[model samples]
Target: MEAPAYQRIAATFRGRIATGVLRPGDQLPTEHDLADQFGVARQTVRAGLGVLVGEGLIVARRPRGYFVREREHMVYRPQEKSRPRPAVPEMDRFSEQIAATGRTPSYSIEVALIEAGADLAERLRLDPSATVVARRRVRYINGEPTNINDSHFPIDLVRDSEIMLPAYLARGTDRVLAELGYAQHRAIDEIFVRMPTPDEVHRLGLGPGTPVAVHFDTGYTESGRPVQCAVNVLPGDRHRIVFERHWS
Candidate 1:
């Protein structure tokens, strides 16, 4: 059986983009023009464009036609029941893990501050208005924006530590915490799916119709004190998150 016309059109455009014939920010021809060029109907062109939009390969402007957008690839691995925990020595190691799964890992940190917020205070069991260190980062996989993570930790615990220092910002919190004598013994993760916020759509370069995966993780020290609280938003189409379970 032959593939559908729209799928073929989509594949053609995708190949062009992948081969650099259509670079990021390059404007695509009008739908009518594409229809004429491909000897297809306007709807076929629209369908092709929709595929590109869903793949984060193009963006449509109100007056302008579609333009090439950044693309990313991501994978989620289930924790192995036999191993219990993978030997991830540092946060950078996670990026390496993502790369090993055949996706590129890139990230940018936006905000890292010591401030007091209702959520952080409650999570850390601190008095209302007590200060904590907040860090926000956007992680990219294979050059595509995939997740926005906002994390908070008690300031008193990390103020003078290497984790708060700019030089160690890229090292990730897990390693720094371990060095500071508060190694994480366990983590609880809660995940849900929802539509992306308007701000998230723009900042994460998502299509208007794309939904996001929300992941909440709380890390605890062996003594049971909460060490960190993180909220991560992942683009739905680009990530495949998995969780493994075991019965003892």
Candidate 2:
């Protein structure tokens, strides 16, 4: 079957972008010109361009033309969290990694006492209605929002601790847990791929058709008690998760 005109137009631009002919920030032809080239109406040109916009390949600038999107992706290794922190000043793994790449890392954190939802309750081994300390953070690189990391802990475990405070933890929450006598000895990481929710779109400034990976990291104390559960939401186009294994 013949592809639609809009699809052909979209494909032409997609190919150019993929092949580097349309580099990031390079402007697309004006809608009128695109319409003339495609022998279609302006609305058809818009439809075609909208496909690229939704795919995170291009963006529209009001009073200007559409341009290829520019993005800086970070490689994420879930296994690194288990490794010892480098001998350096107080900084979380996220901060350390981004800083190593010569990019500034920052975060917005909010702490609250909230009831454990079903998923969190199961992970934390608490009743669904039980209170938990929720430490919500939106991580950024070079001032652009990157991902969301919200950690939940049993209120009793973190009560009166720094984790309950709405502030940056230079040493990270894991260290705070160690100080609280609940040092984690093991953790399980689960990742799920799906489309972003409306709220996620707003928070991450995601374009249409952008998907995300929801990561659940549950940490267990030395005695095998669940102490903390962190949910990290990573934008698919902005991150690459890596894992390593050694068969002993």
Candidate 3:
């Protein structure tokens, strides 16, 4: 059986994109033009373009036509979370990483005392309605929103501590937690890929068809006491998760 007109159209544009015939930020031909070129109806052309949109290969900028999506990926290594940060007087680890890459990093941070939600309550071993200190940061790279790092800590563990402050901790919250005697001896990292929530979309300034990888990092003390549960939201197109291993 012959392929449908829409599939052929999509395949043609997809090949063009792959071969660099169409570059990022380059707009597709107008629907009328594409219809004429493909010898198909305008509706068929729209259906074809929609396939690329769903695959995140292109974006529909209405009032304008669709364009190839641009992508730049930052490396994210989960294994490094438990390692000691450099002994520098930097504000945070994320900023340091970006700086090392010759880019600027900034954040919008806010501290909140919120009731523990079900996921956090279980992770932190807290009672329902227990107050938790939520240190939320919408991290930015070169003035563009990049990711969300919202960490939740048990109130008792972080109350009256630097973690309660909405300002950046020069040594980061992890070191502060250690000073408070809740040093994280181990952590469990889980990554989930899904469609972004509306809040996540707005916070990260993500475009349509962009998914996210939600990293849940739960930390425990040497005695197995849960102390911190961090929720890091990473936009899919903006990050690449990496892991390195050495055979024992």
The best candidate in terms of TM-score: 2
**Model 3 spans > 4 angstroms off:** 1-4, 18-26, 62-64
Q: 194 in model 3: Cα distance from truth in Å?
A: 0.8
| Residues 96-128, model 3: lDDT tens digits | 789999999998999999999798988898886
What would you estimate as the lDDT of candidate 1? 0.75
Candidate 3 has which clashing residue pairs, if any? Answer: none
TM-scores of all candidate predictions against the true structure:
0.64, 0.92, 0.91
Question: Residue 141 in candidate 3 has what lDDT?
Answer: 93
Which ranges in model 2 have alpha carbons more than 4 Å from their true place? 86-88
Residue by residue across 98-183, what tens digits does model 1's lDDT show? Answer: 76787678777654775656756666777767777767778777776777877778887887776555443545676678788878
Ranking by lDDT: 2, 3, 1
RMSD for all candidates, in order, please.
7.5, 1.8, 2.0
CA displacement after TM-score superposition, residue 90 of candidate 1 (Å): 8.1
